[model samples]
Target chain A: MNPRTSMMQGNIAVAEGAIAAGCRFFAGYPITPSTEIAEHLARSLPLLGGRFMQMEDEIAAMGAVIGASLGGMKSMTATSGPGFSLKQENIGYASITETPVVIVNVMRGGPSTGIPTLPSQGDVMQARWGTHGDHPIIVLTPAGVREAFDMTVQAFNFSERFRVPVILLLDEIIGHVHEKVTLPDPEDLVVIDRKKPTVPPEEYLPFEIDETMVPAMANFGEGYRYHVTGLVHDQTGFPTMDEVKIEMMLNRLHGKLDKYADEIIQVEETGTEDAEIGIICYGSSARSARQAMRELRDEGIPVGMLRIKTMWPFPTDRIRAFADRVSHLVVPELNLGQIAHEVEHASCDRAEVVRVNRITGDPIHPEEIVQKIKECR
Target chain B: MDYQKYLRNENFPHIWCSGCGAGIALKAILRAIDDLGIEQDDVAMVSGIGCSSRTTGYVDFNTIHTTHGRPLTFATGLKMARPDMTVLVVTGDGDATAIGGNHLIHAARRNIDMTVILYNNNIYGMTGGQASPTTPLGDIGTTAPFGAVENTFDISGLVIAAGAAYVARCTAFHAKLLDDLIRKGIEKKGFSLIEVMAPCPTAYGKLNKKGSGAKMILDQKDAAVRIAKAEKMTAEELEEKIVIGVLVDRDIPEYIQSCDAAVAQAMNARNGSA
Candidate 1:
């Protein structure tokens, strides 16, 4: 088992990664391109003494994940397109309550179930702002099956550490794409659990925080007998409408992620040191960007690639520097410039930002990106 | 019973208005929990958005005030993960029958071990007297100025059809009976739904000319008939009468236990193969 290697699909790898990360509960509703994740966990979790429930709908699935998280289990759920839309309310609940849970949105074309069986990175912005209100959330876009596995584990760790909901944003291609990879031994993996209250039940305050900005969470039925609510809450974890307390609560939620943005943001860069043309992408779209960059560089064109892993806390500084160094920056996503707009904002007039978008329910091929980069060059 | 033992005194002067039957229902629930002798630490009180959902904020258990119409889903997951704990849900007519109808039926179908205390206020009281699924036909609400044309939901009958192990209906007027029914619902090993027919004096009562909270409760007392007595009445006689008592109680394989058994079998097979 030390040299565990296998050909696996992206969704299967996520399930495997969840198992390895000690996620004891999974509640999900089946949606195309993401159904395999629920199916895999249904077969695997019970064997590991973990719980898997296929909820009535995506909203219920998200609610269940948050509940199980409160019950002291690392929990997750998966869905796509319209299902992701259905989950936004509960996702908002998890955000406000600061419950640790993981959500996997296997992106497919959609305003409403546009194309279920096809690939698209259309949900990138929705991952950030889908849940109503201003709240803190982490979104990770995995580019391949291996990264899906690695990032799923990272998602649980981040959610536990920050007590924030983490979204593993995968596209249809990534969900179904099969890749051969050697996964690390379980003994060698780094797993993180939510910080528990060190104080006695009488002294415990469920939402109190120090410099870490993340409160120690006491699981339900642990005798800490605390309150949890979606409403704006004070340190006591009860609802509050006092203006000062509301501002303080919102500030801590946003500030926690912002304070550690440097450590939380992850990206991989290649050939950007001397290249005049740079392509910035994530998820399966980044796969095409890498191929396009390699092809262009071989043709004596100065091209580079920056693939984003942590899509939220958005790596603004790194992307800004990359944009500044390059004369032209190309953002190739399945949606119409969701991240390209962010790149344009991050570029801050330092460079020309061009978007190569395709929403035809098909993956953007390397050639399309190559054509865009060549045009910019 | 000492109410202070379970009540979160800090959250006092609760959001429930004067004459709101939610307070009555909450007292009955605490009394039932007291009767069962379950520790406050082991009882998880969950609720959805509504006047009833605010019930969690008043209690000192492992309380969770979840999104609208979604407490049962959350409770289901919590119970599945922590089967050692007793999970209870407090929901409203609008929350349970309209927005969260699917979860209610499915939770019953799975026969999960949970006791649901549904407050049937007949109108969306929190939102100011809007018509809900349980608003009786011809009743007036903010949304139904003339008269409500939509058919009302028979909540107990719905859960019974959906396979609840225990189903009961009791009005806020019958405080002792409500307490007993809640205790019975909690004691049942599978899904239990105890619909508490509560009056919303400020909203539903005002709009429908249903008199003050006390007067409405008196109306409930007059309309209520014990199920044993109602059994002898014909359908026409039973119409417009509230049949108050445990409606269904049966033995069934509880969901969490069945899941645990399956997990054990799978582990055993794996060990045997290894």
Candidate 2:
């Protein structure tokens, strides 16, 4: 048999990339845009000696991924809007407890199952704040199928590196798009496993702060035992109402994330140094803006593009640098005004952030972004 | 046995009142797990938010404490991802029957391979003793100060209709029987729900004149009847009676098996082509 790379869609590549990333356990129920992921994993996991479970619902699917992660397996579950809401509580638990699990929420138009097949980037805010409480989250948005594959690997790696749940926010447009992509051979890929505590089982504190700010994990059946709860917890994973412990735990949680925020944040610039107008977008919206940038550049409009790879952890510094370089920044998203709200704050009166909003179960067309760019003049 | 090894080090000694039936239920569940010799790593003890939900933190075995009424969904996920492991969902009547009612029905209807142990204290214990979905009518819970006008839930019958492969009911009063039922539920292949009728001695017990710890167990004495007798009894005769025994046990198609088959078929095809 000859080994060669083949063209594959973004969702399929994510399943294959998960295989490369050593994700052997997958639990998901089929939902639009996310169904291909469930299908691909369902077909591939068994061959790789992994497990695949099509749960009865998305709620269980999310829970299973977290449970499997605890069982010494890299696991992920994929879903869209409504299913994302269902997984919020456990996602929060995974966030605080620092459970290394990957969740792929393919954004679709929705307050409640609004457009199952259509594409919209309405979940940007939900990805950040859907889970109750004040826990720091890691969310990555993939603009294309290739990013879906690459970012999924990064999601697993970040989850392992930081010991937190990593969200890969993809939209229905890219999730369903058919594209030719190259998947690296398994031998060429490096997978990230959860950092097991090297400390003696007796000395292990599941949530104790270390040099990396990530607490070491004591896998089930291992001798070092611990308790973990959703309540404000101490270093030992026990519930603590003490104001000091509360402050310490919350601070550690936030500090672990924002302290190295520079390392976790990712973005791409098309042309901002010598341009006066800017287009800031993510997910599929960025795809259209990339096309619009070329058209605008041809038309003699000095507009540039800044595509966010990491949506949460905001990349405020990168935004600031862009804000300093540009006169006007345009934010285009499927929501009425979410990411624009963040950009406005990060700009902090330095730059005027204009929103190109799209609430319908459709993406912001390139012409619409072009219109926004024309207005920037 | 080092039972304490299974409980979370932080939430030790439990928060149950002296005579609370949840403590008895917790002990029975731990014992059942021990008697079965399930490995600590091989059991993912899932629980929904409630007094019983706290059991996950207390017990070891890859515990997952989810939001209110969502343990079965979580357990179903865990079981699907790790079919070789035992996934047990520990939840209360209010958590499982009220907010999580839909998930329970669907989990049973599909017969996902997971064990759900319901601690039916009849009243919602965690949220200040409100009238739960299973609260007995005419009882006085915090939400029902003028006496409950709502009819109580018969979980076993509903579970039977929802197609749970194994369904059983037991009270914390009958420790041995309750433990046996839990063991049986654990051993079942598909979705098995064992509703343990626990007591809220501090909250619900005092109001119903359940007296003390020992007297509460005594009150459960006459409420239980054997399955053979119950099969012949009429509805009126069964009323005011809490039958304790295995209610439904049958082999059914498990969700995990079906998933495995798809994976297997795909692998076989790939191997043939290769």
Candidate 3:
């Protein structure tokens, strides 16, 4: 039998996708553009024997998500701009503790509540570095409604598998947009659970890792009775003042993602095999970039596009290889060249990076990108 | 009591200083848990960043030493996720009343099933001698070289007004009473707040000429008035007295049970519609 298709909003699709991914707990504070995700879960989760809590604030919500994750539940929280800022401290705690959680940050105008009701891709860098620390995080951005559902599932899977906090970065446009999404059957979709310790409780070291670089997680009440702390800890899960252990732990945290970048990093390239000019963008702006790419190609201009799905653990190698094939690459986003700077760094002088920027809480139009592409030509 | 059974021996030489009342409070908690026979794996202790927050490091339970001022929030999540597990929060005065005040009130308001053991040392012990929210007016702290000008918070009253199901106040001097209150708090199936008036001799004591840690603990004994006697005293008569005992205890709907009921109702509504 064919899967049932339904008309759904982007945030609703994300909430449904979380339920499909076996997320049993959601703790969130209501925020503009992202509040719908919480509202949807509030009504649906309890009916399915899942827990939904509207925490007092964003920080509390983030804390609750990490707490639930440590208790052996697939947990998540959603927020927008200012709320995201409030959650950074606990987000850092989740990072240092190697807790598996999914945070949905719906992009909005920022630099302190700039615009609440409109669209802007201003949190790209913040999602990458918002939490102050040299820690590992996986971030995924989805352009449309269906991708939003798919990426939410992928976010949970990656978080559980890597035992790292995963971020689903969405923009106001996609969050509010309504579209037809045919969700996959629960059986067909890939669902991953964090690896549990095989050793007896007495011998288990909470932070010990093998070649995978990701340690097996033990639930709070699972008789592990282990300790978890935000302070730099050794394999025994106890804080250590030894410099060598601190350095080793930090490296392991970063190396876990670096070694598995091939599995974590994802990018979609269209018409980029033989092109003179390329466009690189993500989230909502990628929609306009794709339109411009198709229009330019149809007009007989050698143009292609690289759409970023995984924003962190950035596809640097792929961007460099693409730049080697193209003379110019246009990086257009809703912010002031956040990703453009990253593209310039990644392209490594192989391509002259041109930036088409927008910061008025409005979607970047295809005409705007087409005009920029023509200027580059 | 077999203190070693509940203690993580490797983390010994704890950060608490000599005469630090937090050690006494920790002992009371361990004794309470031991008396109640809560399994090591069944209890989860969470603490914020402070000298008192160090309690989790020495405990053998499933413990987490979380960020500054946020142990209650984390405990709320852990409790909601695993309702079967007993959750306890250990926080300092500054950690709970200053930075984490919002969480403290909200947790009480939600009436979640958890026990909060608040160590009110009246000053920030770990970060030098800074005046905390519980620091009394005119008490000298490093931040208040002359004297603390700000009025202090009545923590137990705050939790009571915020709708906690159980609220108690005890002092490190009242070690036996502290253990009994904690045992009752753990047995209470809703949000329980037990504010322990722990002394900070190195910080608040030395700055204010409160003599030694033992002397400061003895002062708690003189200042405390049992709840029954204090009820009949006038405001002026009770001004210097720290009313110590169970201040609030009543039956209320616990958060997790309400959540389960809401879920059942929702499922029933859906089934009816189908």
DockQ of 2: 0.43
True C-alpha contacts between chains kept, each model in order: 0.79, 0.37, 0.80
Q: What shift in Å separates residue A94 of candidate 1 from its native position after superposition?
A: 0.4
Model 1, B1-274: lDDT tens per residue?
8999999998898988888899999999999999999999999999999999999999989999999999999999899889989999999999999999999999999999999999999999999999999999999999999899999999999999999999999999999999999999999999999999999999999998898999999999999999999999999999899999999999999988888888898788989999
Which ranges in model 2 have alpha carbons more than 4 Å from their true place?
A1-7, B1-10, B37-42, B60-62, B110-114, B251-274
lDDT tens digits, residues A1-377, model 3? 34569888999989988998999899999899899999999988877777899998999999999998999989999999999999999888989899999999998887798899889889988998998978799999999999999999999999999999999999999999999878887889999999999999999999995788999999999999999999999999999999999988999999999998999999999999988999998988999998898888889999989999999988898899999999899998999999999999999899999999989888899999999889987
* lDDT tens per residue, model 2, B118-180: 888888777777888887888888889988899877998899999999999887778999889
Worst 10 residues of 1 chain A by lDDT: A1-10
lDDT of each: 0.92, 0.82, 0.92
Candidate 3's chain A scores what TM-score?
0.98
Which residue pairs collide, candidate 2?
B7-B58, B8-B58
Task: Order candidates by DockQ, high to low.
Answer: 3, 1, 2
Q: How close is every model to the real structure, measured as TM-score? A: 0.98, 0.92, 0.99
Two-way TM-score contest, 1 vs 3, winner: 3
TM-score of candidate 3 to 2 decimals: 0.99
Query: How big is the positional error of residue B33 in model 1, measured in Å on the Cα after superposition?
Result: 1.2
Model 2 C-alpha lDDT per residue in residues A100-135, reported as the tens digit of each score? 899989888888969888888888899999998887
Please say which candidate is ahead in DockQ: 2 or 3. 3
